[model samples]
Target: MNIDKITRTNPENMPAPVGQYTHITRIPRNAELFVTSGQIGADHNGLFPESLNEQVTNTFNNIKTVLESERLDAEHIIKVNVWATEKIDWDFLYAEWGQLFSTDYPAMTIGYITALGLPEIKIEIELWAAKV
Candidate 1:
């Protein structure tokens, strides 16, 4: 979807998304789009954080690095998919989410999985963004 033409909505008539996502994202024609593969909480040297909070922090930081490399930021994000192996801390996650997106939250989906690429990895995040 084209970033410039993207429209995020949560119809008042419908139930809000269970988490931090919007219910709908409309993308206009001819918009440039970028999709990132799921990012894990691994640093440049492949080190992973043990705590869920630290892992989540690293994952988002990595996402920021990727977006910046493409001349984009959180404002350009339309959707996000998150996966985690451990029980989620909703309050902690939402707090971080608030820090990242502010009020411009995007459509998102989160899942709990049994495992990730590596045993120590606790979280993964992928995103879609656009620029007109």
Candidate 2:
């Protein structure tokens, strides 16, 4: 599924993003937008893992479930925000992300914070999606 009307821009005047993200994402006025609450790194039963990699995987998995519940796919996603309590394994995280977004990268920002909602929660992800 693809929303061709959505626009993703990376201004040439600006430096390229260090990772897989655009500088801006423009959604059409006719599209329906969806905003999700930050999803934490926990399993289906709400169990958090100890390792950062496991937490990252769980976070993305949770986001996938949210999208599925909404009957939406990665093509509808336009923005993503990530928060982490510890240093991330970029390669592992990106691989997990690739399973969802593929080449349809979105505008994104990631922050390394001191903590999340729970002491065991190591990562969180928020998403904004639009369907035309």
Residues 29-104, candidate 1: write the lDDT tens digits.
7778899999888887879978988888788788888999999887789899999999978898888777778776
Best by TM-score: 2
Error of 2 at 40 (Å): 1.2
Candidate 2 Cα deviation (angstroms), residue 98: 0.8
Task: Encode model 2's per-residue lDDT on 82-124: one tens digit a residue.
Answer: 9988899999999998999877699999999998888999888
TM-score of each: 0.91, 0.94
Question: In terms of TM-score, how similar is model 2 to the real structure?
Answer: 0.94
Candidate 1 regions exceeding 4 Å error are 1-4
